[model samples]
Target: MTRRPRNSAPEPPAHFAAADLPVRDCVELAAGLASYARRYGLAHVEVSGPPELGELIEEFGLDEVHFVDSHRRPAVDIEATPRTWRCGQRGLRCLSDQLIDAAHAPPGRVATASTLAEGTVLRFTRHNRLGDALGIVTGLEHYCRDNAVASVAVTGSPALAEVVEVFACERVRYAPLSDRAVSGDAIFARSSWSLPWLDRFHHSVSDTYGGRVRHCVTPLLLRQEPERPEREDVVYCQFDARSGTALPLRSARRLLSQVAAHGDVHVLGGPDTQYYLGHDVTYVRAELPEMVARLLSCRLFIGCDSGLGHLAGCLAVPGLIVSTDDFETTWSFFRNYASLSVIPLAAAELLLS
Candidate 1:
């Protein structure tokens, strides 16, 4: 058997920016980006709102120097003539126009819009990992090597910065915001210009549940405290598994039994074996906040990488994040949360130590 090499050649850096959207979106985006920018220092940002939005930007030592007024174009104005997808609402039609216009704009300005009948003139590359994201950064670096971007402002995660550094991006910047900013009432009215872009981005992305429970609940969990535990002896466990992985039932049960030796262990989310952890271990399907609260009340959070782990960071709860693979990526995203101690699945036997 052949072993794979660790970290090949570094890739180029990408341009990161944060836009001023609804407070909720802005804060979430900021928290994710701040970690990246702080680590890599990629700066060159374009914000869509006023300077006050800088509060979040400064948290990560990132500066927001440029601002674009929000544009509120009607959805019908941007509708596709042939109509690739059905336009259920008039608002969507208006958004179609904005995307078309943005995509057609000249270079220097970032445009995210639907491809028109003329086809997409803008070059696009998919980045699903650090390498891929770095590839995109490399292309951008070659394009603007001499005239380096003032900086890269990220509103995502630090893992994104590692990709940027691979591209040799030295001027990285970040924006950080607390969970309150994400759930607080809108600080500023929706800008007239923002209306059109928001609609177009929403439509182009095809995000169905803009106002649904998943989106609303995750952010809420970041802000609110979990409900008080019903029973002191009931230990809540949040088993967060990454996209492609599983926890062995026997091993997990053994681990749970050890952790909650004196308490009833309750497992929530991901996998059915949680149901078979014996009479002392119960399972429940609750919303993100409820799940988070339950986990907080419990003695420990034992699972693989997942949104639940990320949520634990936001709650500042002491827990363990299990990652049998991709330890670097997982650590990059959750390190800033300050409450998580990541352990690879191979090291489970040493969990208590």
Candidate 2:
């Protein structure tokens, strides 16, 4: 992709007013989006994901949905571990031609070529991890000069979003995927044919956000510390969900049990945490900001290779992230280590001194 050099800040909107936007109930998905765009006076919408998304957006009667392909092409030149997930798909194979074909159809704005100005704010909609989001944004800052950036994420992402602002983002729009008029199709559904989990993430980011640019990995650029309450003797533990890097429940339980024997324990995860961990431990489940606040309130954090561990890292909260062999799969692990302390699952200890 080619971009013009942006040396200075772009001109601001002529009219600006802040208004209270309410979510109104609509019979259909299109009606709700139409109401939202009209109420907000939106000129254009940049959607993150495969191009087929514009077809879904056209149902809303809006013609200005520009698609930013989220599918990523793998780097075949760089040798990687022969993992089950790295299929090494590249080029046109990684793209969604269905969306490319749709772009040429009527309603020119839908799938039309979109342009970005110097101060244009690009908001990323694919936010699932505090560490990944932050790392990719750091790469994005390299390409974006004088441009404002923001992340459109869920309530469970506020803590990381705050850190994103510190890393040069201007705003963090909190609208959970459940609330949006989005089709909720897997962003990787198109690329699943070729790339696996690790490659999909690595290359997609390099393609979409990184733009194949090389930049230095610097210490996290947190400008100011978010005010947190006094720390408590409580230990915060979050080990939920099954993923390529998540620790097994049996191992997580053994570790948390050891930690609980020394002090009061508060678990942070989905409903499953309460069921598996038993009632003896208090489950501290809340939205993102509150979740991070709770993590900050604790003296320590312990979890599997999940986003909460990444959030704990951003707060500089001492903790151990236990992961499987996926830790050695990419160079990103070392890059993230600057902000987070991660240990292999085999070597993680129940007690930290």
Candidate 3:
């Protein structure tokens, strides 16, 4: 959804910026631009940069951005373009006098430790694994909005973009996740050491809400579509996660058996369909929006430590988020207050009880 301009008056021509920075800097540059645009409600802001930057941000320009190329205005003198700006990341300073003179430089300036009102911007990029980025965005969306904390996500996939647009959540092509971490406020996955983005993000920012994002309830600023009837009475479940994070087949089957007692069960059709083969469960899957809608409409959600579960958290869908035996290390990164290292039925019984 597009934000209306700050005022009805005809807006001034967008301030143009020029940059030939490396891919990482360029992506940060775009995050800065999108962050600024979204914050100020510059409905008509225009942005143009290297071909990579253009391709990276153009689609976002339409919905989740303040930067647009519709003007095709001639480039501003290199000196006049907005410069030294930033949004989500930390410690990478740039000049922003031209970007906004009175407003603090490098937009989204961090608040001193003196107060929690850190008008920080939490950035998410599709490039980051869903487990790494989603909770930070949604958590900030939940706890920090009153402080003007904003979430900005940059993604090429319209589907993923749709997800973050709700939280207001990046990347320039070619930047190592390490470099990208500098632009956002929080990264929860402590294992970012190998991921590098997580390491930089966790180490750089101090406020991560004690790292229990899925535990904090969240709602998209935008209202969900009108509730429609779609098995609003069923118990929804998904025994899936990124590759190895999923539960074992026998455990999954046993879990489904227990869930069957709760009413009709819904599972997204996939390789795991085999888990429900002998059980009486309903297959439920669709486009991202439809999928979310279905989950929202469901009576309850129960799933593994996966994106869908986090998404269910955002929608305030009551559910169980079960983890595998590796819950201490590998699965812990995707955890919340309710996540558990029990068998499917055990996790459900414990949390639901």
Best by TM-score: 2
TM-score of 2: 0.50
The digit string of per-residue lDDT tens for model 2 on 1-353 reads 96646764332121211122111111112222232233234564344332333444553334433433432332111122113332232222222222223233211222211222233233334444555455444434433322233333323345445555554443333343353333211222212223322233333333323334233433344555557788889988787754445567777677877787899988886667677667767787776556666776788787765667656765667776666645543223433444455666666653442
User: Number of clashes in every candidate structure?
Assistant: 34, 0, 13
Candidate with the greatest lDDT versus the true structure: 3
Which candidate order results from sorting by TM-score in descending order? 2, 3, 1
lDDT of 3 by residue, 1-353 (tens): 98767654433225665556555445555545444454445654556556766665652333333444433545343332232232221222232223454343233442224212333333344344444445443444444433333332333334334555444332112222343333342223211221112122333233323322223233344334646676567888787634355766777676677777667877865645645354455676665667767876887777775667666765566766675633333233433334223234455555444
Candidate 1 residue-wise lDDT at 258 = 68
Show where candidate 1 strays beyond 4 Å. 1-234, 240-243, 270-280
Sequence-dependent TM-score of model 1: 0.36
Q: What lDDT score goes with residue 117 in model 2? A: 27
Q: Tell me how far the alpha carbon of residue 77 in candidate 1 is from the true structure, in angstroms, after superposition.
A: 44
